[model samples]
Target: MAALAATDSADLEKLLLEVCSSPSWAADVAASRPWSDRGALLAANAAAMARLTTADLADAMAGHARIGSPKAGDATSEREQAGIQGVDRALLDELHGANAAYEAKFGHVFLICATGRTAATMLAALRERFPNDPATEAEIVRGELRKINDIRLGRLLDEPS
Candidate 1:
């Protein structure tokens, strides 16, 4: 927390963008710095998430890869989506189709906190959320983004100062 608070503004915003892709979110978190603790930082994250416009949230979601298809070089997505790795090919194909259906329905990638969750669980969630109206899905997306950001923030703080 101390190290992040002490980081220069541009660098700090860059780091925060890794946690959340939205420039507005990164800037908001950066500007609200000097966090007293991890909890305070998370609170700021939640507050910033709440302030995001629909378009801003879409921008943030754009940073994330579709579930079951973690980008090749993205360690964060690879680690978070580990459950999808080495799974049955049939299951993977199913997940891929579901991902397409989700994107078609929501007009954005399906966002979920995949850390500690199985591919099956994520698939179930995607199917369940498939029926939601845009407004409800957007709200759920914000919550999922919050969870992903919290996990990434924890990892960032764990890095050597």
Candidate 2:
């Protein structure tokens, strides 16, 4: 916590941006630094995420690849969504179609914290959320984004140990 709190501004922003890709979110989290512990830092991240405007949320969502592709997204996404790869072909195809419908409806990728979730479970979730209203779906996306951030932040802070 001390090391992250004491990091230089440029480095900190870069790191935070890698986690969520929203400039404002990163900036806000960075601004709220000097956290006393991991819990405090995580709280700052959640608060910053909550403060995001719709546009900012979209900007962060842009950083993620569409779910269920043959490939996972960026390196971090690759690790977080590792379970989606090498699944049954039928399942993968279904996910691809669901992703298309989701993007067509929401104008953004279907964001989920894929860590620890099996492909079937994620696919089921995607199907379930397909009928959600925009406002509700946005809330779901925000929650998923928060989960991903929490995991990534843990990784970021754990690096030195």
Candidate 3:
């Protein structure tokens, strides 16, 4: 993977395609090029995510529905478990409602970094963000995407070291 980063743009693009899905476009952008510095890589990632259109953002969100609190024996669930707490039945229902409402308003699924957050906290964020206009909301989405990317990348790099 490091070798591919030093290759040409085409190879880099291919490597990115392999490493990240539509939902994780920021990671794809980050992985595509070898960065001289981590800051540059993170900046590029933020820019790439910010450039996504609403439809693109929505597509990304749809691709990541299962990224919430991890269930036992589920990697995603486990990842989420560290971030999400107090996700009882009532809170889940509220989250569902907030998700639906946010999607309805923006035509995209709500995007957030669920790590280390309670269901109530997530719900509050969703409700607060619901009032943003498209332009404002896109920035918010990009911020959330960055946070999620950071968490995922940390996990990826921490494997069995």
Clashing residue pairs in all predictions, respectively, total 0, 0, 6
Residue-wise C-alpha lDDT for candidate 2, range 1-161, written one tens digit per residue = 78888889999999899899999999999999789899999999899989999999998998887776524335776777788868999998888899899889988899899888888998999999999999999999998999989999999999874
Which residue runs of candidate 3 sit more than 4 Å off their true CA positions? 1-20, 23-32, 66-74, 81-86
Supply the TM-score for candidate 2.
Answer: 0.95
lDDT of model 2 at residue 142? 92
TM-score of 3: 0.71
Candidate 1: tens digits of C-alpha lDDT, residues 75-120: 9989999999878998899899999999998899999999998889
Evaluated against the true structure, the overall lDDT of model 3 is 0.63
- Candidate lDDT (C-alpha), each: 0.93, 0.88, 0.63
On lDDT, the stronger of 1 and 2 is 1
TM-score of 1: 0.98
Give stretches of model 2 more than 4 Å off: 70-73
Better of 2 and 3 by TM-score: 2
